[model samples]
Target: MDSRVANDDVSYSSEAAISRWKFAVSRQYQHLLDKSTPHVLHRWIGCFAVACIYVLRVYTVQGFYIVSYGLGIYILNLLIGFLSPQVDPEIHDGPGLPTRGSDEFRPFVRRLPEFKFWYSITKAFCIAFVMTFFSAFDVPVFWPVLLFYWVVLFTLTMRRQISHMIKYRYVPFSFGKQRYNGKRASAESTSLPVD
Candidate 1:
């Protein structure tokens, strides 16, 4: 004899209504991304604008407090993401680092995808911009000292990241560069016959 019957109250589906809703939302987001991608240059410009505002505010106030520290932390975080390989060699099949010809067939995938990376940077800048409006964020201290420390921190962090890139045989800007095959198919036709 049949034990179960199909009914709304007696349903045993693995995916609930909430799950379907979430899936629909995700698909909509993916569709939006497919239509167009964000320009990184524009995002960087936004970040620069935010930084300029922060700098101008600090210059007028003559001191930086918690906002400066927050900015430093955010910059360090972004740098770490920028320098590190998105695809970890340990997890993925590779010879510790991406090399030419060793795994040419394998597509280079990043651990930290570009969309999220830029999103975080933009978010940080916006937060800093908002913090500028509040008086409590201002700390009574020599603004020059904070600027000096930021410069020093940036230099050291960048130096270490550059060395890591050199050692690992990877370039973060590989995605940005135009890939050239070093061949000209029309070269032979373009040359006039010597005779």
Candidate 2:
């Protein structure tokens, strides 16, 4: 009975140690993510690098076309979410984006923020890259057909999204609007023009 108690205590202590270790590792990872949050360019560069690596891996294997197709579809969905507003004007019954120039300026909020979009894309590529190693994902299919189909879908989706933007009179991008660099005209300048 004493030996049994000792063994149980040892296992409990080991489990506690492992839990603590995992918590520490999780906290460290979260800290790194927080630090990287402000560095948008760096985050994007890292994601791009991961994407390139995944592409290279897929190209070298010459398989996993299904995984690639699934990844492409997932990315397209993410892109649409990133481009769209949180509450779509046409679908939801609420105050939508400003349609006229005189309306109040409300900044466009994305359904999926840029950081989440980047993270999801990076993670998806990583998973797809891993899937390429396994033969199960390497289902044989004509690559050109998938490519052509993705292109057609992308074109149609983008066309609809652009039309939605036009209808709502809202631009998703921050720099899409024209900036007023010239100085504002004073009341005196307008009076002189009247004379």
RMSD of each: 8.0, 3.8
Model 2: per-residue Cα lDDT over 1-195, one tens digit each: 999999999999999999999999999999998899999999999999999999899888888888999999999999999999999898988777877788876788999999899889988988988888789888999999999999999999999999988887878898768664334545545566544
**Tens-digit per-residue lDDT, 20-81, candidate 1:** 88999999987865653566676567667877877787668765566877777786877688
Task: Evaluate all candidate structures by whole-model CA lDDT and list the values in order.
Answer: 0.69, 0.90
Runs in model 2 deviating more than 4 A are 178-195
Q: TM-score of predicted model 1?
A: 0.61
RMSD of 2: 3.8
Candidate 1 stretches with Cα past 4 Å from truth are: 1-36, 89-93, 100-108, 175-195
